[model samples]
Target: MNRGLYEADHEAFRDTAREFVIREVLPHLDRWEEARLIDRGVWVAAGTQGILGLSGPSDFGGADQLSDYRFRNVLLEELAEVHATSLSSGFSLQDDIAIPYVAALGSDEQKARWLPGMCSGELIGAIAMTEPGTGSDLQGITTSARPTGDGWVVNGAKTFITNGIQSDVVIVVVRTDPGGGRDAFSLLVVEEDMPGFSRGRKLEKIGLHAQDTAELFFDDVVVPHENLLGELGAGMHQLATHLPRERLSIAAHAVASTRVVLRETLEYTRTRRAFGRRLADFQNTQFVLAELATRLDVTQAYVDASIHALNAGELTAVDAAKAKWWATDVQNQIVDACLQLHGGYGYMTEYPVARAFQDARVQRIFGGANEIMKHIIARDLVDRPDR
Candidate 1:
């Protein structure tokens, strides 16, 4: 089916992104995977290519025309084609998750100071939200930033933080006013050079080998009061305001990753033979593949519609939840079936399918769990007396 979701400008941007990925990222994927983290130099290279910060202001050395996120969607589609989910995730974290906070909340001085560095890849940004005991429960974080005369004193720890090991500046989510309800939490910038800010062991994950995820600890890490990301006691609102973008980014990845596995499976099935007959000759295989293709087409449509809605600023959290959960669900199912089609080779790490299968498992769990997504959707659809 023809997907007319992107304009000519977006198409041009995709071409640029593809060139950047193929030249800089693809060649380095294997080495990075073996190392378990992408090299810091690549970030600088991406900045030089003008691909790192697509959504920052021109004055800040970022792409000035980043209003529409469709460019990023297309970039994910291209990267996903090569079965590089880790790379896709890293880039998405930079362009989608981190840049938004800088653009939306950072003050003029902050923007001038950070945006240029962020856009140019001189600074890698990360947001620390999930702690050891809390996942999806934002208010349950035990990390705290206590007020002081000069600034604020932050202390505690965070786990499962993406880009933790390499992030130049981490936006640490901490409780500022203990009894301030859901509003007590606030995000403060904790720089790498801070006195007591430390990154713990880089946790091994089932997939995303090239993407760094780690635990962070803070002990009397003082953040200048100006480093507070948004208004004090507005952490929930701050997170709520941009979650739709985060979810949409996940949905984009889900759809793109599905297409990648499907494409690879189709090619493999056509070439591999059983009893002198190509695997594609089997009726059952064809039927299963037909189902996958149909589902991909259907979900891709929904995802594209969601992207459009995101651009128009009308995408709701409920709709994003629907896209995030459903597309990832379909993405996982398709990959699992595709892996089954590969028989023994599917389980081997040598094949991209195996890695994708493992990596896709985490999608339903993060960016808000699939269950949480359902809760959000349910709230909007079901009538409640409490409301």
Candidate 2:
């Protein structure tokens, strides 16, 4: 399982990322979870460490490692080692989703205004796509922005938004045309203090307590025409183009988490005794661990290859769906089995396995539900025009 996925530079970056997590993440994780929010200070610290804006150009204060995703993968693995998944998810949102979208779609002025601060972690960003009623169906979005004197009046609500509570810049997806169609939607950048832009309560969830998730409301908020991201009527295309990277990032997290839980389980089984023998001595435990290890290795290979494909700009949306669904499925399965092996202790929130079990469930649901992933894959296999 050498994988050979990382180069010397990636390993060097890992050292830096690992040190940061140990210093900034591990000690505060419990307190963050208790408060139901991470302190903004951690975001600044990560920016200073060059971990927040890997995708931005060096001129924007980023590390300029966007094309090589291996560095991001390295950071994820290091975070997974300590079971700091909530923080991992938050950072992933910055590096993988929000930053990339702005970098790809923002005009020069937009980039100059936003990229440097985003790289510095002084500015937090979130993409608001899921409405109160819409999840995967982008066409169903009812949040509409109508043209007005000098700007557009935006009205809508978005729920289940990551970084919603803390985001300084939000790329809000709104319908430019009342009539629903592909050409109807557009992206408007809404700033923090915009009138009628408000955040609802921070949502409580089964897991990811340390990461902020909230409901956002926009009622009659006037967004400048200059704040528009990309072309009008191109929000759908922009979202589709960027979704593969989000899915791949999720796959990477799933694989790294699976490896961590499996490793911990192995160590637990070898040390803990039951019925006058170590748990590892039991035939049942041995078979279970054997199966889990094999599955992890197999899944890791696909994710690794997917990472390479992503770096080469060859990872298709369909392939990303495959990696996302399969890797997360394996991750959840392995974590559940590992938890069961821990007996009652696994049910305790203090145990990382228990926390991982809760955290792993959302992977299959977010970044497009695994069922949606299957639909995408199935459509490719059965509904192609070539067929």
Candidate 3:
């Protein structure tokens, strides 16, 4: 399968991204994993390379690549090649989830204040949505923001927040109306220095060791009225509007990562001997690879089409959910099988496949669980009942 997904410009961008990963990311990966955090310098280096704010406004030093998601796909592919799952997830949190909210909904003043720093990677961003009690149920969030004379006082806590520890700015989702309706929630941009805003301990995870996932607490943190993102009482709609892109972004990474594991497994089987014969010479090995390859090609086609659809503004939440769940499920399965093929070596942390296996677990969990994705698809099916 030629894929035929990238043009010359995209290929050129791919080269630049690959070079950046090789130089800036590969060397420090081990140290970062040991420390459970990526160095702040890499973000700055990425910003310097014009990679951080691809979809940001031009006035704020962004390339404004939002319309063309293929550039982001290129970056995802390159990161996957190195099995940099932690780094890839961290970047996606910024580029796909957090930045888009600001770019799309922030006021002109908000844009002027934050976009430049975000684009330059001097200011990291995180979106706090999931609470200790709320996962997919945004309506159930208890984080409250009350209007005050000077500003809004925000009080709540968020868990499983990516970049939580390092984020210079956090877009905190808080309930503004206690009545519990669709219009109750609003997003408040909480800066680092805000009083009563504090970060909990960095969470320990089975994978994504270098990525900072943490719990955030807002205790009477006063966010200025000007810091509200999007219209008040419209948080649910805003989150709904942005979710398709976020899911698609996850799907892109899932497929790219699956391809990396498959490629590496192919090479490993070609040389590694089993029972005095090459692993590739076995019929079972050949059959397994053939099956995996077919699935990869078919899934790649659908994902590519979805990318094009997303760029054209036609990607629906249903479709994005399909891509996200399917690709991530396939990625986990493929990586597990690849690890099986590697036998004992795959279990060793020294091997990329082992780390990939661990990292792939969360794909089905986050960006809304795969189960949630199925619920969305099922709901759509019932609603249409025609197609």
C-alpha TM-score for every candidate:
0.97, 0.98, 0.99
The per-residue C-alpha lDDT of model 2 at residue 280 equals 99
Model 3 residue runs over 4 Å out of place are: 385-387
Candidate 3, position 62, lDDT: 86
Candidate 3 C-alpha lDDT tens digits along 1-387: 588989999999988999999999999999999999999999999999987888887988888988889999999999999888898888888888788899999999999999998988999999999999999877899999999998799988999999999999999889999996999999899999999999999999999888899999999998998999999999999999999999999989999999999999999999999799999999999999999988888888889999999899999999999999999999888999999999999999999999999999999999999999999999988888586
lDDT of each: 0.88, 0.92, 0.92
Model 1 C-alpha lDDT versus the unseen true structure? 0.88
CA shift at 217, candidate 2, in angstroms?
Answer: 0.2
Winner on lDDT between 1 and 2 is: 2
Cα lDDT over the full model 2: 0.92
Q: How big is the positional error of residue 127 in model 1, measured in Å on the Cα after superposition?
A: 0.5
Better of 1 and 3 by TM-score: 3
The lowest-lDDT stretch of 10 consecutive residues in candidate 1 is 378-387
